[model samples]
Target: MFTIGLTDHLEGPPDRPSGEIFGEVADLVQLADRLGVRYAWFSEHHAHAHQGHLPTPLLLALHLAGQTQRIRLGTAIICLNLHHPLDVAEQVAVADVLTTGRMAVGFGSGSTPEESALFGSVVADDRERQTRFSEALRVIRSAWSGDWSGNVPHAFSVPPHRTLPVPAADLPGRCWVAVNSLGSARIAGDLGFNILFSHLRTPEQYRDYCAAYRAAGGEGLVAANRPVFVGPDDATAFARAEPALRTLWRRFRQEGKIPAETTEPANPEDLCGHPINFIVGGPETVARKLCELHEQSPFDVANVEVRWAGLSHERVCDSLRRLMEDVVPRIANAKSLTGRMPR
Candidate 1:
């Protein structure tokens, strides 16, 4: 099956009440659950008030688990280098127990210098950060198996004792590693973790990342994250999502994430020509784009972002409905006819 998943950074304006944002996310996940979305992923970001504000994904997953019946809840990533691996292992284990083993986790090295400073674990560079991340992940997996014994500096340290609240037996099967580099992808594969590719990458990049993962013996899922918004038709979808997309682009521009030479997109055509390829259209259009992506990269799951930059709760819910109820069936049909789905 061409499985589809949902991911959210819990983005909202600073002025918006946190409760409203969380409530809306809960509603979206519940909607997806009822509509048979395979997974619901939440991201973690610290002190990010207006954007990427959901700092505790496991907590949110536990909360959502009580509300929804079937959708598997996961951390799109937890910045493992910033916190104790033992603590994370404990929380993940508890979540598995309470959610009846419907929990998943994606671990990554922490990003941004400010976050590292705040966490009191400032790494010298990406290499050091990844080293720390590798160590932390090993400790976490060891703790899950109750066989932990290592003391990596600035990563983790403990005496000869098993961490409390052992994880579910199948928890490691659900572990993922968020990766932007081939080295990280290989590491994720070599360590028996699934791969979560960055949304910013192109299809060619996805192919290369998948190749690296497979070369390193990765046999688990390969998830590609992308912003997706579907509506009744192409024009309606573009019009509805463009404003929020503009808001997102402007913020990224201000943060130096977008090139200054790039102009704000005026319409769907402009968006198609822009650097970021957001999947914005009606059901058929969205479905076609996703199929094209799969044909190019051959991934296992489409981890989509349906909400962005102050987009309304109602609009998001509608998009999720169209995506799951409409777009997904089209993909499945295409796969059946063309045999394009990854084996």
Candidate 2:
């Protein structure tokens, strides 16, 4: 079965007054849990005024752990290069316990140059960054296994100590790497970790990544992050999303972060330009498109980003509710639906 999850964005209303976004997010998580979504992933961005709303996803995930029962909570891509590996491992391990094993950690080499500078760190070149990221994963996995030995040094002078109250025997968490390029996916596969392909590439690009993962002898969950919105009517959905969508693309372009597209289309259909970038429409339409994409790549999970560009909390929540209550069930019932199936 394919898993369905929401990606939480803490930024609030773009042009209207709305209450706290994160507070609404907590409510959204509960709704998703009740509606039977499989997971909820939160992002990590620091010091980007417009985007760094959620700097502490772990803290937020802990709060979500209390509010949710069955849905898995995860970091979409935590900036592992900015913090000590042991510190991240400790926090994630505790979160896993709190979530009772329903946790997935997706690590990435930090993307934004501004975020890196604000964190007072140099963004390593791709090669160096990938190496550090891979090593950090090894360290984190070792820490979780409670097998601290070998090249790992023991602080004999400090005092003999284990990390802390481990979770119950049955509660074990899985880890994933958020990859943007084929090389990143291959590295993730080589490490035997799950892959979380960011929603910045085309379906063709992801197909190649998935093929490489299989070829590399990696077997685990593979998912992609895609923006999703399902409204009762197509016209209403597109009308509401178009302005904000344009603003979003413009902002990314201003920051020189637009994806591999040559030019931005004046129309909504051309918005993503890349096939796998975003999913926007009514439930059935979006479902059909998603299924078509799934037929090509066959992802095990789909992380839906329902909140983006300051959409109203109510609007975002309503869209999510519609997706969970309406679109999700249809997608679940349709056996032949392809692309990234929901879990």
Candidate 3:
């Protein structure tokens, strides 16, 4: 059956204590666990003007581990090419142990050049980035399995013992790769990792990518992230979302990062006009659209990014609660129009 989850985005600056946000997020995860949401994925970003916070998702996961019991915690997409593979392995291994084996590591060749520069990453060509990422994944998986034969020294090794924690036998799984372009999707398919397509393309594109992955013998969960906000009234939801949505688009346009042919709004208020840009509606509307998308694709998880630019934290949380209460149960329990939900 399909499950629902949230992708955490801790906005603002890194100097600000994440603990402030963590309190709220902890509450959200607790609610999600009670609501039967399967995963809570946190993203890693850096060196952005708007407080490019959350430098370490693994740390956040560790903190959440103390607060949550059943819901899986993960790095939505940890730019694996940035750090030494051994370091990544050690950190994730500890998180897995802390959470009692409830961890999913999602990796990607990050999109923004600014972030790459900040991390002192090589900024290699896409092919090379993919190659390095694949190699790192191998190293990380080997380290986690405690069966490494390579001469690579453990970065945090003790005199006679390695410091890394060994994950329990029931560890949820290894890393998932976030695929935006078709090339990455194909690589993810061939390599057999979980896939996360975070609203980077249309539903049709996602379906095609999923088909390719399955055809290539890839397995494990396939998930997507979509921006969704549900409220008691559609007008209130849209009104509340206007400012943040505008700011997000403005920043993207000023940076020349807007997708091809996607025009910048003359005013931030008009940002919602961009079709399929964001999902704003009440329960039934949101549920129908989610079910339709699932019917058309093979998504085992649907992660809704409920937090956006203009909406207040309270509003975002309320929207998510409503979604969990109204939308998720309907979609999770109902059979897809085609047949049973994708497992």
Candidate 4:
């Protein structure tokens, strides 16, 4: 069946205590689960200045596994360079067991230079970072096997043994590697792993990315994610989303996180016009765009974000409700008419 997923920064303003923010995320997740969103993806960030909380997405996923019966738990990415692959494998295994095999994992090299510095990761250059990530992935997959080939390190020096609640033998097919470049996409394909690319890039980029993936033997899931907002109508959606969109853009620019060619867009219309990479519209409007996107890129899953720049939990839930109830079905129909429906 075709599937949809939701992702979040689990952001809190700098003023609030961290605990309250986490609590709010839990409650919001419960609401999303009830609304029938398929997957709950937590993003990773550490010591972000504006409070991009939830540094340990795995812990949050594990904590909610018991509470959420239907929603699968995921990490949009677990930065692999700094983490011990064995630890990552074991934790993911435990999460898989806890969620009854409901796990969709995404791995990445690293984020900003500061984040890499804090972790003491060897991000001297892109090649070095990719080397670290590639090795970590190898060790993680080895650690999940019955033989667990990563045992060489622990056996020689470290001394941890297999613990309780090992992962199921089979992981869900949706496991992914977060990719933004042609190289990452090519490697992800060669490794036979699925790839997750952001909507921040254009649909044309994704079309090229997917073609490269297929050429290199990638045969698993292909996911695309975007900052998305839906409302009762276009005017209301634009009004509610404008400030948040601008705020997010400004921060991205200041941090040098956005592409150099882009400027912070002040107009809501400009933000929604595909230049800024956000989907903001009424139900039908959003639906049409999603259809256009699937026709072009045909991502297996559209992992969307409803919470950004201090949107209220109720508002996020409402957006998800429309997404599930109205947008997704129309997208499917659009796919059929265009003869490019997702699997």
Candidate 5:
């Protein structure tokens, strides 16, 4: 069976206090730890009230590390282009130490032009952004390896400098690259970093990107992220999650994240079949959909998005519990016994 992990955006309504949102995230993570989930990741965003309010996911990870014992905690992604690689490297190193080597690092270029521009790193095109990302990653790797004294060849270069507090051993193996295109996938492969495929893409696209990564000699882990919600039954899950899905899709469409021509699904079954949608249903259905997803695009890890689009803390906790206690065990048992899904 594949590794099962949970992802949270830490998003809440504007009416609520940010403190309360953070508290709820902590509680959910603690509960997840108790439920024996393998990993938990938090997303990073800056000045986006409607999106995840968390500006520094690494900071949040440090906080969560103090509370949870078994579950690995990490940043879903840190916008590498927005900050100096030295600072980022130091922060990651300290967090790794504090978490006792249970910290994973995911890096990417900033998603939107607005957020990039806010940090004075304008995304004129993908090429420029990629250059910045590669350069920063090179430096971060160098620092973590304790060979920081060297001139890295890039527009952003460092000259024989060192960053304090080297990361825990084998940090590179724990590093991840958030892939949005074939180019990024190849880069991740070249750097020997894990590749995380976006939930926004279709299975075909995911397969294509994975092919590119493997072709580039990427020997690291492959992870797939998707929106997943579970409940006692299909109707209950659909009713609770559909509105949030609608709101999330509407916002994504407005922001041009998804193609305008793509139509939204009308029901739970349609969602499971849609090219760019999520998995939402009862335990059996959720388990089956997860198996289908693995068959469609094989991955070593499943990063399940359990909280988004202003889903309530209670709703998220119930879904997480069902996913961990009900859905995951069935998948595990089926895989162990027959090497295939039951349904």
Candidate 6:
């Protein structure tokens, strides 16, 4: 089965009250759930108004869980290095219980130096933070299974009592790591978790990640989180969406150089050879783009990002309906499963 989900960043002006965003998100999620979208993934970040307003995604997800049934709710990632892992374990466990086994989590070493500094010296550096994140997985799983030994890091003491909302047996297939490299993909696969990739990376990068993941015996499918905009036609769609895409370009424009050909774009129209990843088109074109993406990367799911990229509420809703009634049926027939991993 293939899965399609909606992911939003709640990116808006900081002055926008949290309640307004929450209500909008509830509506969006309800629409997605009713339309048979398999999962609703939310991102977690703190100290950044532009990236997302919701610092506590699990809380919002829990609220969403109350409003809908059957759709899987997830944190695309909760930065593990910044917070005590046990605190996260508690939150996820509660979310799991409330959602009745529908809670999926993605963990990451903190991403930026600025975000890292918010946590003081606990994170150390990228390598050290990654190490801590690696240890955190073990600690969290140990808490899940009611096992007290082996994986707990020495920095923290184990809880004497069994954690409530003990994880379901199939959690290995539910949790994920947001991967950007072959190495990270292999690590996630070796550790027995699903994987997430972003629109910024090329399909070739996805190919490398998937190959290494499969080499390491990964069972769960690789999923892509992409920004998508749809309209009545390609021109209208691109014209309406380019401004937001440009903003995204500037947002992701960072100090990094990797593959020589894929350097950051000089202008908004420059897609860095990844137009399909941005997903601007009519229904037919969008459907075709998804197929093309699957051809190269074989991703079983696409956690499509809307709203945050500045599409109007009306347009976002209309596009979502199009994705549901038009785009999805052409792509896959997957329904919301209780906890089954997409094949």
lDDT of each: 0.81, 0.73, 0.72, 0.75, 0.80, 0.74
Positional deviation of 152 in candidate 1, in angstroms? 7.0
Candidate 6 structure quality by residue, lDDT tens digits, 258-315: 3434556654446524533577788888877777777666777887987855566777
- For candidate 1, lDDT tens digit of each residue in 273-317? 334568889999999989988788777789998888747889999
For every model shown, what is its TM-score relative to the native structure? 0.93, 0.87, 0.85, 0.89, 0.92, 0.87
Clashes of each: 0, 10, 4, 0, 0, 0
Give per-residue CA lDDT, model 5, range 1-343, as digits (tens): 7777777777876666888889988999899899987778888887764466788889888899899998888877888877888889989998998778988888987656677778887675777777778778888888887776677756656777667677776888887899988888888888888878778788898899999999999888778888888989999988898777787776777767767887876764564434346889999999998888788888778888888765777898999999988998988866532332110
Which one wins on TM-score? 1
Model 6 score (lDDT): 0.74
Alpha-carbon runs more than 4 Å astray in model 1: 149-155, 272-275, 336-343
- Model 1's alpha-carbon lDDT is 0.81
Q: After superposition, how far is residue 71 of candidate 2 from its true place, in Å?
A: 1.2
In terms of TM-score, how similar is model 6 to the real structure? 0.87
Model 4, span 115-159: residue lDDT tens? 778877656677766666666776666667646443553322335
Report the Cα lDDT for residue 301, model 5: 80
- Any runs in candidate 6 off by more than 4 Å, and if so which? 122-126, 155-161, 253-276, 333-343
lDDT tens readout by residue for model 2, 1-343: 4678777656643443334667778888898899888878888876544555778888888888888788888888788887777778888888887777887777887657777787687887888777777677666666766656555533211222465555444332267888787667877788788888767777787889888887876777788668887778787888777766776777677766765454777787677544326677888877776777677777888778887774676787888887877776777778896443333
| Least accurate 10 contiguous residues by lDDT in model 3 | 152-161
Candidate 3: regions farther than 4 A off: 13-19, 49-51, 151-164, 169-174, 259-276, 337-343
User: How close to the true structure is residue 142 of candidate 6, measured as C-alpha lDDT?
Assistant: 70
Report how far residue 156 has shifted in candidate 6, in Å: 4.1
Q: After TM-score superposition, what is the CA distance of residue 311 in candidate 5 from its true location, in Å?
A: 3.1
Worst 10 residues of 6 by lDDT: 332-341
| Candidate 5, residue 125: how far the Cα is off, in Å | 1.8
